[model samples]
Target: MSVNNIHEWDKGEYNITTDIKKIDRTAVHSYLTRSTWAKGIDFETVSYSIDNSLNFGLFHREEQIGFARLITDHATFAYLCDVYVLEEYQGRKLSNFLMSCIHEHPVFSKVRRLMLFTLTAPWLYAKYGYEPVNQQNYAWTILRKDMYL
Candidate 1:
């Protein structure tokens, strides 16, 4: 995918791209390992996951500064997860830009629901049409954790 096609959301400094080849898993692994929310991630496993996912990575001068993943069936449900921006690259609004690309993508546009879980940054996602769902009503089961590992 061409970075030029990505819509500039929240200023034009960031270039969002869905092509996972542009992702630097090493850099992302370093960032995730340092993040409190992602301390459990295994870089080798993450590298494999990114290699196989319908994921998007945000770039600033060839660096993998931000990332988000889409878990989807190409018809119905899509869960957005592992959204992160590097510490040095934060405050540049790349998350919003990356999200805009995902939301606007042809595949995601047809999805019935987009779900995400965040321990922090609720306000940031709230502005992008994400709201808290009553967990009591929407129960989730983890079908496979070992597969990713």
Candidate 2:
């Protein structure tokens, strides 16, 4: 029961890692609570989610600055969610670097589908081959917007 699927990338002073141990739970929960999609989420729920998911964290030197998570089985499907870079950290292409690490992950080779929900950064995702769900018959969700509130 060891979850050790980690990948890391370094560019100058910025680094991205998938080692869940490196995640700063307090920083992540603070950000998600204020995010449009996850506002008012409690620390316990956020902690539980991180404990269960494959997480990617971005850091500057040693301080956590950004984060993302993949809810996946590591075999069939993956849902990318809760991705973000702090406002001060944006404009540095760290998001692109984050996506690169995710796309290059070996687990994806066996994954049949990847999905994500975003109300922002569509252009950034588009560059990595994500597109609007076929809208006709391919995409759907039973979205409970306030499920955690």
TM-score per prediction, in order, is 0.81, 0.93
lDDT for 51 (candidate 2): 98
* CA deviation > 4 Å runs, candidate 1: 1-13, 142-149
State the displacement of the C-alpha of residue 55, model 1, in Å, after optimal TM-score superposition: 1.4
* Cα lDDT computed for each candidate against the true fold: 0.74, 0.89
lDDT of 2 by residue, 37-123 (tens): 999999999999999998889999999999999999999999999999999989999999889888877776779999988999999
Residue pairs with backbone overlap in model 1: none
Deviation from native of the Cα of residue 147 in model 1, angstroms: 12
TM-score of 1: 0.81
Against the true structure, whose lDDT is highest? 2
